[model samples]
Target: MPLALYLLALAVFAMGTSEFMLAGLVPDIASDLDVSVGTAGALTSAYAIGMIVGAPLVAAFARNWPTRTSLLSFILAFAAAHAVGALTPDFPVLFATRVVAALANAGFLAVTLTTAATLVSPDRKGRALAVLLSGTTTATVAGVPGGAVFGTLFGWRATFWTVAALCLPAALGVLKGISAGLVQEHAADGPASHTELATDGPALRTELAQLARPRLILVMLLGALVNAATFAGFTFLAPVVTDAAGLGELWVPVALVLFGVGAFTGVTVAGRLSDRHPGPVIAVAGPLLLIGWPALALLAAEPVALLTLVFVQGALSFALGSTLITRVLYEAAGAPTMAGSYATTALNMGAAVGPLLAATTLGTAAGTLGPLWSSGLLIAAALLIALPLRTTISTGRGIEVPR
Candidate 1:
């Protein structure tokens, strides 16, 4: 709702574009660098690894700095990394640059999410998070496709240059929109303010201990499982549509566009509902995915049915996603920055694992249908884990911890 929050979303858009654009340019990168496509694909893995390892580390290192300062610093570094990536001559250099870029992206995301939560009232945290995350969904719909087109026309390096250029505006937005004094005010008003913990050793330790609670741990696991379930089917969506659903190759892009539209819609709906009823929203999201997947496997042979199911699946997954992030913040209401970093790490882990699981399934007799069924069972397990926790839906002052 605040100008600062939208600025943070803009920053996320730049980062999300850089993160996903590589998926579209892998073939070009492999050929340019004189490596196998598999090796170039490892660049994606390298970036995910950096995100998982870098988020908490950066959050800890920047714990003492003002939120605005950390965010700007990270984005500057992210922009610089892309510049280097565009100029790199060899695969090794490009791979290392990818890691650096990912670290910067992870740091930026952790600080931005915490800052966004602080900018809004407690009841609006879920909606705020959805607004920030919309950047990623938008990237999938627009930026990735744009990058692919740019890479095809110019060169892969040109796409990286464009990503670098995008970050400049985001950096300027953070500089102009967020101020040191505003950061202090928002932190003071927030449910979990890191400003006080940054200087107090004992308070920081207590905050870390709160994050280690069994309830919080369960929520993190659920976050990982939910993402894994979503990605499992998504990683091989093209094959599923073509082979399993008996659709033409031409239909793959159409299906993806439909899914992206559904995702945007889902985030919008979830943001509004989560502000009032996060617990109930989360409870339904997983089960809906559970039901949707099996139905997809059964009905995918029909084009209209397949397209309808894909859209629904996208909507359900993203709706669950926003709530999962909100749930983590509620559980770790005393350490929002650390909680956000942990949530990012958990989600990245799932993103890496899901594709592997799907690939293995595709190798089996079950083929493409394996991902749909597997994802359903995984969501079912996640729902069972999540249903028992008592989440703080809303509080007048901030999210309240259950005693």
Candidate 2:
């Protein structure tokens, strides 16, 4: 692996940490701002909205800029946003800063992916993408947990401040290291580059156009459904454990940590498994979804059953998640960055939908089990969608031909 890959991973790690740490620190922020949890929840949702919007916009508009310049600008922008977030005294100001930070976050990810594709040989692109994505997975394991701990010890504002400090080191690494050539291609034709892929372009176009195909549409549809399934129950985890499982407030952070652990393991395993035997890896994630539903239900009914089932549900359901993105990249050969942005945007849309569904479901149900029940059923539905694709999808290997 190139040293640049490691630097890219560090950048992703810092970004992921900054994004996810908000979940654990929402209460602190809410308390400090004298706002409701629902309002503070918007802070998370706002970031997702920013990511969805910024991904394509930046990719399209900033396509002509140098990679180093683009990345450095994004990092500096992200640092500024976080600095504002750390210092803001009012909720509205903080919300605006979160939106800016999210824009930086999305742009950073899109560029990182496009750069990774250019950094390695064609055949090794999957692995290259995985190396960069590891930062996201690793964040679940370490960054989020560490941020949560920091928030507990210091305050929510302190977490953002810490992230800003971390950003400086990440920025320095990228500034000093990335080659100018690495990012130049992303802007190659800007909008005109479609002609470059002619002959091969149609195949790539068809792959991206698959976003509209029924089966492909099914996959995209499930992206939102799957996340909704997780978030519906997850968003209200605190209330559920407290009310239904008879757990204390302390269990909330503990549960999140467990969720993080499961997700961390899932992403790492999925990356490796997808490379070796993607078919079976994706196949297994389907049944894992079904199993997780019952596990969550059982755990909800008997809180003592927490550790085993919750962890299982968290890990198994998400195992094949990012692998699906890899599959999309496989299909979208020439326009990998746009395809990546599409995949990510779809997931973000799903994330947004999931929370809305939870708000509605949890509002009506007598207890926390309502959202949990809803999330489980949706996950099972996602399983049905994923199972058939595994049998039909065929991704061929390739050697790097002249561009």
The candidate maximizing TM-score is 1
TM-score of 2: 0.84
What is the per-residue lDDT of model 1 for residues 1-403, given as tens digits with 9 covering 90 to 100?
8776777787787788788788779999999989999999999999989999998888878866777688889998988888998998889999999999999988888777777766676667778888998887777677777787899899999999888888877888788777663442243335533233234333556667876687677778888888888888777788888998788877877777677777778888888877668666776777789899899888888889999999999889888877776777776777755767877877787877877777777778888888888888788888776666545322223364321
lDDT per residue for candidate 2 within 115-221, as digits (tens), equals 66666555555567668767876776689888989999999888888877777877877777675534323232232111222232233344356566554455556
Residue ranges of candidate 1 with Cα displaced over 4 Å:
181-203, 390-403
Q: How well does candidate 1 score on lDDT at residue 182?
A: 46
The CA lDDT at 305 in model 1 is 91
Alpha-carbon runs more than 4 Å astray in model 2: 34-37, 183-218, 394-402
Q: Candidate 1, which ten residues in sequence have the lowest lDDT sum?
A: 394-403
